[model samples]
Target chain A: MKNQTVLFRSPVPVAETATIAGPKEKEGPLHAYFHYTLEDDLLKQDSHEHAEIRLHVGVLKQLLNRAKLSPQEIDCAFAGDLLDEIIGSNFAMRELDIPFFGIYNACATFGESLILGSCMIEGGFAERVTCSVTSHFATAERQYRYPLELGCQRTPLSQWTVTGAGATLLDKNATSKIKITSGTIGKVVDYGIKDANDMGCVMAPAALSTLRTHLQDTGRTVDYYDKIFTGDLGYSGSLLLQKKASETGIILHNHEDCGNLIYNRIAQNVESGGSGACCCGLVFNGYIYDQLQKGRLKKVLLMPTGALLSKTSSLQGESIPAICHAVSVEVIE
Target chain B: MILNKEEQKVYKKEIKDVAPKTKHISTLLRAFFTGGTICCIGQGVNQVLGILLPSLTEEDRGGYTTLLMIFFTGILTAFGVYDHIGNFGGAGSIIPITGFANSIVSQAMEHKREGIIFGICSNMFAIAGPVIVMGITASVVVGIVYLFL
Candidate 1:
C-alpha cells in the first residue's frame, strides 16, 4: 500500500457483471452492450424512486443469475445511490438476503464499492462480493433541482442524470482474466465553487488530483493504461481535466469520460452529457467490460469522480467538494 | 489540495473561461416572441369573451382570461408540452401567468405519488412560493405608501 492506493497481492477476479439501463440510456451509443434495457423508466412502478429500486434489484439478480450463484452464496453486497439517505440501495437490499454495506461517495459511489469489495476479498474477509450502484433521472431531478414536470431550462453546463443500475460480482477464487489490480482512494478537494449547476467545474479538480496521485504512487506515466476513464465529468469538465493535467506535465491523450460517452449530447438534447452514480457503473459494466472481455482494451484505469453536495448544502451557499477514486483493471496474460 | 483565496479566485476565473457562454441575444429574442405570443393569446381570449358576453365588465373579462390561460397551461403541463416550451422560451414561458400555473401544476403532478396532503398540496408552491411572498410584500408596501400619501 502506498499513500492512498492499495495494490492487491493477488488481483481479485471479476466473475460476472450486469447492467440495466433506462429508456433514455438505451438510445445512447452503448445500447447493445447493456444486459437489459427498460422500456419505461418507471418499470410499472408508481414513482421513480421505486423504479430505481427495481432497477438496482434487477441488476443484482441478473448478476447472480448469469454467474450461477445465489444470494446465499455471495458473502456480502456493497451498494450505494444518489437518492436521499441512499434509500434506493436500502429498499433494494430489503428484497435480498445478503449482508449489505451501504456506501456513498456521491456520483463516485460505484468506484468506492469496487475498491471496498476488492479490499474485502484481498484482506481474506470475503470469498465473493457484489458491488452495485443505482441512479434515476427523475428521482435525482426532484431531489437535486426541481420537479420533473417543472417548466425550466437546463443550464449549459448542467448534466443529465443517467437512469440505470449496474452490478459487478467479484470472486476471490474465480479464474478470470479481468482483475482488479490496484485502487487509489481519493481525497475530497474543494475549490470553493458555489454553482450547483456547474458540477463539472466543481469535480474536475478532484479528478485531476486523484489522477496525479495515482500516477505518482504507482510509478506510472500518462501511457500507463489503455485509457483513463473518469466518471461523470461532462465535455467541459473533461477538457478542464486534460488542460490542467497538461499544465502539470501529464498528457492525457487517451482519456475518456463516462458522462460524455454515455449519451449523444447534441442529439439527445443533454446539455453537456450523462451523469449520476450509475454513469460510470452502466458504462463500465456494459461497454468497458465487454471490450475488456474481447481483448479490445488490455489495461485501463477507472476513475469515478463525484461532486459531494446536497440540496441543503447548495441551498445554504456552501461550496461544492468533490472526490474521485481510481481502480486499475487489467487482463492477465 | 486546499487552495488559498487567490488560487480559488484563479480557478473560478478559469472555469468561467472554459464554460460555454450563454447566448444572450438569441435568448432575449426567443423570450420576447414567446412572451408576446402568450399575451396575444390572452387578449384573443378576452376579445372572444367580450363578443360572447357583452354585459360582463372589463374586470370580469380580465379575470376570466387569466383563468383561461391557467387552464390552458395546466393542460399543456399535464401533457408534458409546457416544459419543452419553457426550455425554448426560457423566462418567456416562466415570467407569464402560464408559468405560475405550470410551476404549481407540475409540482402537483410530480408529487401525486406521495398522496394529496403532504405531497401535492404542500409541494405545489415549492417553486412559486418565493414569488408569492414577494408579490404580497410589495403589494402591502404599496398599500401603506398610498395610505400615507
Candidate 2:
C-alpha cells in the first residue's frame, strides 16, 4: 500500500509490560522505573549472545506472568534485537514456543514490533500478542564496533548502547486503560551522513520525517498529544529535531527523546546519551507505560528512530539510511 | 522528506553546534602525564638494569628492560590493576609497551572461558594482532633496507 498511515479501527490495549536492564542502566536516572535489573551485563551467561537471550526470556516471562497468562496463551510474538541474523530473538523464540515474527529495523525494532502487533490485533489476526525487542551493550559493541577489552575512546558524538530488554503484551479484550490508536510506518530517509559515530545526525532527519508525516496524515498538530517522544535521538539529534520542527512551524512544546531521558548525561559519562533498540524499549515499557497507568498521560506520540547501517556497509563507507515508526497511544479512561 | 544537498549542509552545521564537544584538554592532560610517567618509569628501569647487568651489552640491556616492562604490565593486567590505570591514564597507558602487554593479556583473560586453544591462544592477540602484524612488516622493511645498505 502506498499509504503509510494505519489508523486502527479497534484500539489495542497493552495489558502488561516488563523491562530488564543491566546494572549501569539500572543506575541511570530511570532506575526506579524498570521492573528488573541485572547485577552484571552477562546475567552469569558465558557469552554476551547468551546473556542477551536470557534478558529477552526474562522480560517475556515477566510480562506473561504479570498478565496472568502463559506462552501458550499468546497467539503470536513479534520480537527482534540488534544482532546479526537476529540471533538473540531467534534464540529466545526457541524457548518461547509461540508463532514468532522476527523483525529488524536496527534500534527501531521495538516500535516496529509494536506497530505490527497492533496491526495483527486490529486486523483480527490474533487476540493476544507479545511485542518485544532486546539490545545488550556488550553484544552490540562486539558486533558493530569493538571489543570491550580494547578500551577504545568513544567520540563525543557517539552514544552508549543500552544494555536492556523490554517486552509488552497486547490483548484485544483487555480492560487496560492504555490503548494503541494509530501508527505511521516510516520510509527510509537518508541525509548522506557517513560517520557511524554520529548516528544521531543520521537519525534525526528520519524522526522528523515520520513525525511530520504522522501529524499531516492524522490532520493533527503537536498539541494533539500530551507529549511527543522520539526514540534514541539523544542530545544532539533531539536538539536538531526541535530546531527543524520550529523552523517548519511544528512547535513541539512537550517533546522528549528516549535517548536523552534514559540516562543522566552529567552524572553518567554517556557522551550523547543512550542508543540501541533498548533505548525506547526500556523508556517506553518502563516510564511511559507507568505514566499511562497512573492516568497522567492521556495520549502520547512515540517515534522510535533507527539508523539502518550494517557494520559491513559502514566500513565500506556507505552513508546510514534511517527509519522511524510512530505509534499513537491514548489512555481510554 | 530527505534533505537536499544545501539543506544537508545547513543541518550538519546545526548538528555540530548541538552535538557534545569532546573534552580534549582534560583527556590530553591525562594522556600526557600518564604517558610521561610510564616513559619515566621505563628510563628508571633501564638505569637500574644497567647497574644490575654491567657485563651485558647495551642492546641486551635494552631488551631486558623491555621484557621487564612487559612482565610488569602482564601482572598488573592479570590482577585487574592495569584496567584502572588505563581508564585513568587514557592514551598514556596505551602508548607504552606495558599497554601492548595489557591489551593481549586482558583479551586472553576475557576469552579464557571459551577454552585454551581457540579461546586463549587463538584469540589472545585479537586486539593486538594488528600491532604485531604491522610491527613484523615494518621490521621486514627495515631488514630489506639493511640488506641494501
lDDT by residue (A1-333, candidate 1, tens digit) is 999999999999998999999999999999999999989998998888899999989999999999999899999999999998999999999999999999999999999999999999999999999999999999999999988777788899999999999999999989889999999999999999999999988899999999999998999997969989999999889889998989999999999999999999999999889899999999999999999999999899999999999999999988999999999999986
Q: For residues B47-79, could you state the per-residue lDDT of candidate 2 as single tens digits?
A: 998898789898988899899999988888787
lDDT of 1 at A167: 97
Identify the runs in model 2 with alpha carbons over 4 angstroms from their true place. Answer: B1-8, B50-55, B78-84, B109-126, B140-149
Write the residue-wise lDDT of candidate 2 on A1-333 in tens digits. 127889988789999999998888988989999999999888888888899999998899999989989789999999999999999999999998699999999998898999999999999999999999999998888778755665346778889999999998999999998999999999999997888989888898899889988988888889899999999988888888898889899898999999999899868988888999999999999999999899898999999999999999998987789999999999977
For every candidate, give the share of true A-B contacts it also has. Answer: 0.73, 0.32
lDDT of 2 at B69: 95
How many Å off is the CA of B59 in candidate 2? 2.5
Tell me the tens digit of each residue's lDDT in model 1 across B63-121: 99999999999999999999999999999999999999999999999999888999889
Report the TM-score measured on chain A for model 1: 0.99
**Which stretches of model 1 miss by more than 4 angstroms?**
none
Global lDDT of each model? 0.94, 0.89
